[model samples]
Target: MTTQYAKPLPRVHDLNRAFFLGALDGRLVLQHCDACGHVWFPSAQSCPKCLSQEITWKPVSGRGRVWSWVVMHQRYIPAFADDLPYAVAFVELEEGPFMMTSIVGAEPEDLVCDMPVEVAFDQVTDEVALPKFRPVTGEAS
Candidate 1:
C-alpha cells in the first residue's frame, strides 16, 4: 500500500517570529495599499495591482464567510492520523482577503458555502500560531 501517512512539509516561514507574534497578540495584520485600498495576504511588500511600495499594515476584523471547502478522508501524514477526516476551506475575510485555512468548531456535515465564520487562533508551534475559523457567534438570521 502507498504511504497514507507521510510527514507534512515544514513551514517555509517562521510564523511565530513574524506573523504569529502579532496574530497571537490579537492583531490581524494585512498589507494594505495606500493607493487602491486593496489588501494583500501572506504579507506582500508591494501592491499586486499597482506595484506601489507605498503600503501600510493594518488590523482587520477576523470575520469571513466560507467561500469553498473540501473534506480530506485520507491521511497524508502520521501527525494527521487523529484528524483523518478534516475540512479545508477558503475563508473570504471581511476585508476582501481570501485565506486558505482549516475549518474548526463545526463538523463537515454542517459546513456550507457562504456560512459566516469568525477567526480563532491555533498555536502549532512555539512561534507559529495559525488563524483558524469557527462559526460566527450570535449569527444574524
Candidate 2:
C-alpha cells in the first residue's frame, strides 16, 4: 500500500525485501548463516565469512548501543530540511551487526557513546518501515 511518502524509498529487491518486511511487522530480522553460525545485516546472497549460500532471515533482539553518531546541522537533502540538526547514529546490535539510524527518544545533545537503544520502526510508506532506534530508559546504563 503506497502513500504520499515524500522521502526516498528503498529499492525493494530479493536481497533486502525480507528486512523491509520484518520492519513492517515490527520485528528485526537479520541474515543468519547456518554454515558459519554468523548473523549480519544488509542482507547478502551468501555468508560473508564462510561464503555459504545457506542463509536464513531470522528475528533478532532489536537491542543495541550507540557506537557513534553525528548531529547534522546541514540540510543535505531537501526532504530532510525540516529534520536539520538531526542525530544520525551508528548502533552496534547485541547480535554483532551495526546499523545506522537515528535515535528518537533523546535529544542530540544528550546523546553519549554506548547509550542503550532499541529498534523502533518509522513507517514512511505503506510497504516500507524504516528501522530507527530509541533510548532505553529506567535501566542501568
Candidate 3:
C-alpha cells in the first residue's frame, strides 16, 4: 500500500481540542450550548445564539446533505497538487450546522446540490482522521 502524507493537521488547543480528539474515535462532534441548546462548528468560547459560555462537546449523526460544492481543477497548494480535480463541499448537517469537507467516493461531476450524503472518516495520519462525505446510495433523500 502506498502511504499518503496529509497536507496539514489542525492545531489542537484548549478551545477546539475536543473536535480533533473526537475524530480519533470516529465520532463527529460539535460545540453545543447548554443554555440555548444551540449547536455549531468551528468551536468558540460562547454560544453564538445566546452568548452562553457553557459549551459542551456533543456527538452528531454523521449524516447530511450537500449544500454546495466546487471542483478544484488547479492545485492552489503544493501539497494538494497530486489530488487535483477534487470536489470540496459544504455539507449541511442534520443538526443544522454546515461543515466544510471534501466529497469522496464519487466523481466530481456526480455531485449535486441537496444530494444526501453521509460522513466517512479518512485516517490521514496516526493522530488525525478527517471527516469527509460520500453520496448515500439506495436511500431516498
Candidate 4:
C-alpha cells in the first residue's frame, strides 16, 4: 500500500486558537464586535468595523451560500496533488462573515454562485479538525 501524505494543517496561534478549538468541538464561530455588532472571520484581536478590542467568539448558524469558487486543477502543493480538481470556495455565512473553505461531497461542475451550503468537519489529525462545506439537503436555502 502507498503511504498517503496528509495535507497541511493550520497553525494554531493566540489570535486564531479559538477558531481551531471550536472546530474540534463541532462548533463554527466567528469574532463578533460587542460595540458595533459586527461579525468577522479568520479571527482577529479587534473589530475591523469599530476597531474595538472587545471581541468575542460567537457561534454562527453554519449556513452559508457559495459566494464564489475556483476549481484548482494545478498541484501547487505536493500534499494536495492527489486531490486535484477540488473546489475552493468563498462562503458567505448568514451572520455576514465570508470564510475561505473547501466544498466537499459534490462535483466541481455542480457548484454555482449562491448555492446553499452548511458546515461539515473533517478530522485531519487527532487534535485538529478542519471545517468544510457541503450542499444543504431537505432544507430551504
Count clashing pairs, candidate 2.
Answer: 0
Pairs of colliding residues, candidate 2: none
How would you encode candidate 1's per-residue C-alpha lDDT over 1-141 as one tens digit per residue? 233333353364532234556676766677789998888677666798799988877788988999999998997766877886899999999989999998889998889888999888865555455688999868861
Per-residue lDDT of candidate 3, residues 6-87 (tens digit): 5976777889878878987899999999999999988999999999999889999999999998899998888888888899
Model 1 worst lDDT run, 10 consecutive residues: 1-10
lDDT against the true structure, each candidate? 0.78, 0.92, 0.89, 0.89
Per-residue lDDT tens digits for candidate 4, residues 1-141, read: 233427877888889988888998999988999999999987888999989999889899999999999999999998888889899999999999999999998898989888899999987776788999999977554
For model 2, state the Cα shift of residue 48 in Å: 0.9
Sliding window of 10 residues with minimal summed lDDT for model 4:
1-10
Residue 46 CA error for candidate 2 (Å)? 0.9
Clash pairs, model 3 backbone:
none
Q: Lowest summed-lDDT stretch of 10 residues in model 2?
A: 1-10
- Residue 52 lDDT, candidate 3, scale 0-100: 99
Best by TM-score: 2
Query: In candidate 2, what are the lDDT values of residues 97-139, reduced to their tens digit?
Result: 9998988979899899988999999998888999999999976
- Candidate 4 global lDDT: 0.89
Model 2 segments more than 4 A misplaced: 1-3
